[model samples]
Target: MSLDLTCPYCQQPFQLAGEQPGKHANCPHCGKQFPIPASEVRLSRKVDQEPVPQRIAPATFWYVQTEDGRQFGPVTEGQLQAWYEEGRITANCQLLRKGADQWQWATDLYPDLHQIGEKKPQGAAAAKPPPPKQALDRPALPQSAAPITPLSPDDFPTTGAGLKSLGPVLRPLPPGYGEPRLHSFEALEDRRKFAPFMVAHMNRPPLNKMLLVLGIANFVVGTLRAVLYFALFLGLLGAIGAVDERGDERVANRAAVSLGIAFVMFVLNIFVISGGVGLLQRKEWGRSATFAGTLIGMIIQLTCVCVTMMLGADGSGLASAIWIVLLVLLLPSILYDAFAAATLTLPSVVTDLEE
Candidate 1:
């Protein structure tokens, strides 16, 4: 590199090859020899003044030397220039100088800048600019005198620096912002049961879309099944009543009476099915109607089971037992739906109270 025709020591304009990094160069005018920044001789430093409010940007970077435990600014050009003018370079301050090949740091170069005047400007002391935000942080900012702009993802460094390039810049998220939210839904299974329960059960009012749908479907199906099954049973009973069997009158009467009783039972089953469906659907009318029907169905089934065991044939007894088993099977779903429907009803009840 070419140098101005002046001596660095005396400001003489004489020119020479720029001093090799470590060589000591002398000026003909002043005979002063200053060591060039290199391995052999280094300019040690001391901080002449503490950081001033105007001198330091709200945010700046500093380099620390591990060997000597001194901090210096290499990238902060303005701050470094100020320190240089202040003659703060000492034997203890950290220095990070870039060489032809690689960057080297030294701690015995200057004093800490903290010794400078510690006073800061009054009223509107410089405030640091806010940092970037992450996903898990605040969803939005609150309304305030000065609105804050949200940070973008691009503000953060995605890759770390390496031997070939500068290290990654890691800017901390600002206060009031939260951590990044998890991107994957892999953990959703763990929360499935609890999430639904809370939405369905705990919130003063229920707001579950799935539960509501299920309740309604149950009511519709139950009503339809009740209509069909009771219709079939009654039709069979009517046919029996119309029969004129030549057999013993006692036999005919018994058969006709049993058929009548079964028809009656069928009529009741319709009500039970209707009620169960209604409760599942979470309709207020359905919930109540089903609850009543289920209880009655249970009673009638148990009674038929007893009657069959005492008077009917073994097949009849088994059929009655099977019917009882079915009734038992339906009991839990009916009860749960009743409770759920009732739970849903509570909100309306509360609203009524408020009104």
Candidate 2:
């Protein structure tokens, strides 16, 4: 009689000799090894019987702490092994398995994760020095060994007799030898507060200096213009006074209007000069004022350019060419204003200023 058996891996059925019952044999259909069932057991099972399910345990995960006191979590064991092999994690790193209450040193917890170097064959040659013992391999000192005692001033030698009487003293090592060094996060945060300002000051960009120079130049030009306007106003006042009683009313009215315009321009120029000085000093308000002036200047330039373009459309070719040339000449000032605005608005500069 032949005995029937099912392969666990492939679930294929095959037959063996009755004498081969309870013996391992390769399945004919799947070529897999399986134990031959006894004749009595084989007769009890039907050909349509369902395969039994195998129970397997779920995968385990671990958490790790970095040298910087950062906690990385729920990582698989394989990933930890990869990190260890890649040098991202060190032997001194702490790891805790999922659901574990305490952490352990990685090397002590998973010794098999790292490979041991091959041992040299014993021969008639000089023997190599023994490998240094790992921290894990060090045996704990017995309780009977000397207990830790408080240190006294006598521990230090001030005189020759004190030094001679002091013998070798064994002290207990401090706790958490493999732990990461402690660092104060608060100190780091405090330094960060001023870091941006210090960096900005140390490496002041060329653009900022250019903006300052532009501001100073603007102030000087405004000062000269103000002086010229003031002189013109005084001259206009004297001319009005010298006008004959019988002089034309139209001429007198024109002089008064011109004087008023000059006075207004002088006052406006004073404000412009002040704004320029503020810009040179890197004041926040100075930046705002300078930006406002730049906008006004740009608007006036655009309006003039548009009017010239329209008027020159029907004028001589030379007139049109002149208008184009004027526009081109004004482009640099407009671009400089834009550059200054952008430089002042930079985050580093903004952070350096008071609110």
Candidate 3:
């Protein structure tokens, strides 16, 4: 049933079908985004009541948090019914399945889900007997304006006129060759094989091995700088020993405070190293947090460099130059990776199934 409902945004009526809940059907008049819910058609009813199941007229969507703390899309009432019928998901379950292969839909249902015990082993499915042969009528040959040539009975050497015992059975032309062909079965098979491989290649992971290598290198260098800073602070404290004993005490205390601050930086560096590498590996949390943290770090580093230059800093030029170089190396890469990760398409899942 398609219901004519006015889009709130556009004030234009559009057709809403029960099967298209949460789908992006729009107003033709104004192009305002609108979704069709089952209730809009006034046709929702329990299709099956045997298991105490009820199908509501319209389903509302809710954001669900998975076990791993990732938020998924809105789920609908029809989807909820299907999920309950199938054992793959549970009602009100907090824990969602692992593996990027699992799905969370606008409705709690897995529309792509297979019916239980429906899948046959590939080999067994392939072993079915071949289909029967189809008869083909011989096409009439063009008549030549020449005397017809005929073969003598001795040319065939048959015991009965135009008859012979069967020597071998011929294979059948496939199902496509049978009468009332709706479509070519051979063309369908050819299309299926190439379609998936091409799509899979196109949708392959955003990060190549090279990006992962760069992530690892970034982590290592950050960790090394943190360690070197700690050593530098200790050496600075030692240098203050040449001053008067009381003055030296004050310098040593300042050095100790600086070392403590450097230690915090060390911890952050270690976090970046691990988190960034994890993101490159495509771990969900790793991908989100690494980029998020690195972005913050980039801002902080730039600010620190500005403040230091403003203060007429007297640090060793080599130390400052090394930091500048490291900052330049990492910040752009982090930003690029973050943008890429966010924009990458949701990995494709089976969107439709044939009966």
Candidate 4:
């Protein structure tokens, strides 16, 4: 490719082939080199900065693999159910979800979608004597399967970047001999369990996307926080005993009290960790534990900070540890807890978790 440039020294236009921005280039007319403007280099990036976020298509979302080799949809569970009932597809027909590699048999992907449909009114084909001739020995499909109720757009903002629009996109696959199926993470057997557990893996809360993310964050943060505080509790226990055996009795009592408080913090973090795990499993207790633990931890942490400040602290081990715990640890912990508690209460988030 060639780039158009005006020679800075000569004020003359010139074209340079095989040139990239940010390097010095000689002016053809004046024979003087000047640096290319890095300001306009949109593709340039700093290595220290985070990579841009990429969008992941919904996993449970699917496509109808037609016999004609032309696939249709970026369909949702509800849309797929509707298509099946209307006789547009069958249980044994091929279906390819957005993230799956091989086209899967409909019933294999969703056990509940077993070629059932609602019975037509009395003027249906069942009333007449069946014709003997048939092209395939396909079993008669049920008039209906259990109804699927997708989250209503009224309740959740479907247009958000994290979720596909309520209206399924019918865009055709791009022209290519080989595509998405190039990589398949799970084999047929592995998929058996994975299919059922996909919602948990998606790391997304019910229509309200924050719950899933919050759950994950809680799990990681809670785990690290628990380990940190628990270790401190054990160390404090050793110190409390040693100080009582050798140091001042008054300082020993203070150390014992600190040990008790450390124990409380450790237990609270454990509940926080448990809550995160629970949410991942879609259990109501998980959400409850996470929120309750966060709130209580925040209250205790704030009280400790206020009391420690009001009653001037000394240059002792317990006081220094309290300063670190209060300013370095609890401040962020309190902020995260506040956010998590509020997120848990979102109407959509609560409904999704409860359901």
Candidate 5:
């Protein structure tokens, strides 16, 4: 082994060249020769070792916490995450970024939350962490659900720690089961306040599903109506051909009028179909077009019903009443238009489309 020795001439340290016992060696520092002791202790080994360097934690720009309106630090992502896991900071602690105006939750800022614990603390030897988190002797299930009382906004915990602790206990559930969503609370509140037996029809998000159904339905209905209108137009044209205006001006004029109506309807249906396609693509214009078409359809259908009843009723009160009643109950086209209008007007649907 090479010997780590002090050069007696210069009092400087240097390693000897060879592994064998030597009598004389040159001091690289002073450039002077020195005697190597024959039976001195070997002060060096094959491998040279040095103390590992202490790693410094890197930090980012400053952030302000919302809870106490106090700035946390110019801290690394890992350190912030560690504070969160330690419950020194809660999810409700909204942080305003260095150059930003609005504040966002820590979870929103840091997605790699649970993994931060795996990293060694920066300067772990010098820093003193908070009291070691302890396990409760009592069961964790009940505590997981902090609020056990009936659903009431008044009774709800408004504090961060309280709210953080409030949630359905994590069960050893099978697949497709997990933490109860926050929306479920809204359902519970409604049920308790309204009808106990009424179950929430929609627990999942409605935007995508409704958009798909209504968009496709609009497309299909518009196409079918267009085909019907075109067929009627063709039939009218044949009538006009069979009975020339010269032969029967009245019949030909009526046929011409019906054909024009059919043509206009077909053109409108094309717009409706385009609107439906737009809706499927989640365009604002599609929602607007579909909504406008729905309103026009409702108006036209109602007008037709009124006009037909007045011109054809002939004072048959019973028949006219029955007709109006049936139309009100079973006018699928107008009713569907109204329904579509309602869905499109919903704030959730509108907001989703904007997004």
Candidate 6:
């Protein structure tokens, strides 16, 4: 015959063969070991009627007190048992179940808790026999000797004779030994004032690193543009020479003017690239120079936009559209410059530069 069993820990119902009462079994679902209750046996009945399954209510929660006078929980009996088995709660610890009036020692309340995982010993060896006590009889001493008295500080001499007998006297420790050193209030107050700024400075490194990458990229692109412009200037010089040979003075003069403009552009590119390098090094002057250059570039861009609009009004559709696209592309750079300008002026950055 099979018996229906409910796991006390997990409340999972399972079938068990007819077995001894109070036998321990492991729950298949949660793998927790629990004793089978005596009331959990299947009863024989008529085959025509369906058997009504018995419902098991949840276990009452118990509270345990620590050795340090701290009380913890409303934990389940399973949890408390686990704690007991794990040695977290000792046998001497006090526990009180829900609706209980008084607290009691865990070992006194649950005597078999410590034997949960221990195997019962078999045979005569299981019953430990008490050791027999041996007599400690001895002859009494004679009464003539006086009893020894405990020594007191007054028994020792405290004068020059005692010092001479004891050898050289030890010197006292130098001044300030074991003394608590005083700190400056002003210094502590200063640290308190700059605590937030110090945090900001520590967090500033990531933004600074990003700015350095941008600076390097700007320098590299400017250098490449300068190289291209120089090549173009050489080509223009050749073209101007050819125009002069053909006796077209106006065209040659225009070519020379174009070459001059390219040379100026090359110089500006060199300055801009150098500024980018300085900015990467976080130089204060570099920030100022870059800010001035960006402001000038934005002004020039606005002027170009105005010119493009004027030309568009005269039916230059392609140029207007191209200029508008360029303006849209520059928006990110404009915002970045604005952010950089604001960040550079922060108190933390200023303090870092000073340092």
Task: Show the colliding residue pairs in model 2.
Answer: none
* True-structure RMSD, every candidate: 21.0, 21.9, 36.7, 32.7, 21.9, 25.9
- Model 1: per-residue Cα lDDT over 1-355, one tens digit each: 4333445566775444643665666776788876554532222121223454554224333332322332333333334333333344332233444222223322122222222222222223133212221112222232234332322345322244542322332334445667778845656655655586553444444434544553565456556646655675676566555555444565456556656655665565565556545544444565555545545555554565566556646445336666566556455535544554454455443231110
Error of 2 at 70 (Å): 41
Q: Which structure among the candidates has the greatest TM-score?
A: 4
Whole-model lDDT per candidate: 0.45, 0.57, 0.47, 0.65, 0.61, 0.57
Q: For residue 137, what is the lDDT in candidate 1?
A: 23
Give the TM-scores of the predictions, in the order they appear. Answer: 0.29, 0.33, 0.31, 0.41, 0.37, 0.33
Give candidate 2's error at residue 262 in angstroms: 1.3
Candidate 4 Cα misplacement greater than 4 A, ranges: 1-207, 315-325
Report the lDDT tens digits of candidate 4 across residue range 71-98: 5666556555546546566443566555
Lowest-lDDT window of 10 residues in candidate 1?
Answer: 128-137
- Please give the distance, in angstroms, between residue 348's alpha carbon in candidate 1 and its true position after superposition: 15
Best of the candidates, lDDT: 4
Report model 2's TM-score to 2 decimal places. Answer: 0.33
Candidate 1 error regions (>4 Å): 1-204, 207-235, 238-243, 312-355
Model 6 per-residue lDDT tens digits across residues 1-355: 5667788878889877666567887788899988876665423223324767766665566677654545666665555544554455654456666565556665565454333223323325334222111212223223323332322334322243313221222334445467676768987677667795665555555435545765775587557757966996998989988998899887777678758866765665565577677777666666565555455544543554566567663344345565577567556545544554465566654443311
